[model samples]
Target: MIIIDAGHGGVDPGANGHGVTEKDWTLEVSLHQYHFLRKLGIQCKVTRDRDVLLTPERRAALVKQSGAKVCISNHYNAGGGSGAEVIQSIYSKSKLAKQAADALMAAGMPVRRVFSRKGTAGDYYYMHRLTGSVETIIVEYGFLDSAIDMKKLSIRSFRLQLAEEAALAAVKYSRGVENSLYVVQSGAYYAKDKAEKLCEELKQKGYEAFVRRMN
Candidate 1:
């Protein structure tokens, strides 16, 4: 199962967004991601089903209870900042976190770098203390107040793009088996070129490789 948490809700309008509230946007994106994942046969559970106040602890408990392999906490950070930032569990070196973070980066999510805060930063976020080794990521997806970002969020097409990136990261990170798998991405550009180059390099290393283009 994959646990999706839409941060802050109800009367608590986390980071007011011009006329839009962070709570509302968070729920919207979270639901979008959850439904998309479910449609693809991935199990999903949310921390808050509707608008309501929930402490970080309660949210974390929900993640733990869901028996999720990964917890994706969706949120819109405040303070008039912009760009995407994902907080991964302290296992920064873990291949799972590396794959997820790299996927997001390669997909061009506006992020500086993925960081580990568990047991180091304040534990109130709940994502900090995990009952298991579940790979978790709390993504603060741009600022609601930023004019540039708000303009993008105003479009459903744009939000769906974000969800796509999240989905891409989830699949890549969760499935590490080396096999014949093709990731559908925007035309044969960076990823395509990279894959082609890797295939050639693998051949040099005495392994057959091929590049499959997506339609």
Candidate 2:
């Protein structure tokens, strides 16, 4: 089961972006994810079904009561920044989490860093106190007010694309579980050979490296 928490509803909008309320967008995106999950035959529940305020403890308790297998807290980014990040609490661990993280990386989020505290996943909210499951992550999709992210939002299909992306990931991770890590190096260069050369230099520096070609 998936618990989708649309952060800061009711009185709390969390953050404002280009005149769009954070609460509204979060709820819309969360609902989209929920519907997509159901279409995939995945079970899910939301913290607030509508515009009701929920305390952190209350939200966490809801998750615990639902016997959910995973938790995803939906939120947006603020300021002049945009991208996606998955934040895990310091209390949960499971193969599903790792797979979910990798899927997010492949989903074309601005940032692809998975944060965990000692293999446990949760963010800076009620997720840790409430989640007793194997996988729990906070999804900060992108910055709302930033120039780059605002442009992304202007696209009618970005949020839906995100929902589709995350839904596919959730299906892969929570259902089709896999475990392992691969060496993925990131850099910028004009030519593919430059990347290959960098990989070679790193190998000489006593680190395992591989050159990946990109079109």
Off by over 4 Å in 1: 94-108, 118-124, 177-215
**By lDDT, who's the top model here?**
2
How well is each residue in 1-215 modelled by candidate 2, as lDDT tens digits?
77788888888889887887888888888887787677445788888868878887788788788877677788787866567667777655545445555565575556645666442333455576456653667777778887777777656467767755665666566665454333355576878888888877877897756553332
Q: Rate the local accuracy (lDDT) of all candidates.
A: 0.67, 0.69
Off by over 4 Å in 2: 92-98, 116-123, 179-215
Query: Residue 213: error of model 2 in Å?
Result: 34
List model 1 lDDT by residue over 77-186, tens digit each.
66767777777666445555555555555655566456666344443345757535566777776777788667766676666667656755665566654332354332
Backbone clash count, each prediction separately: 0, 4
What TM-score, over all chains together, does every model reach?
0.72, 0.72
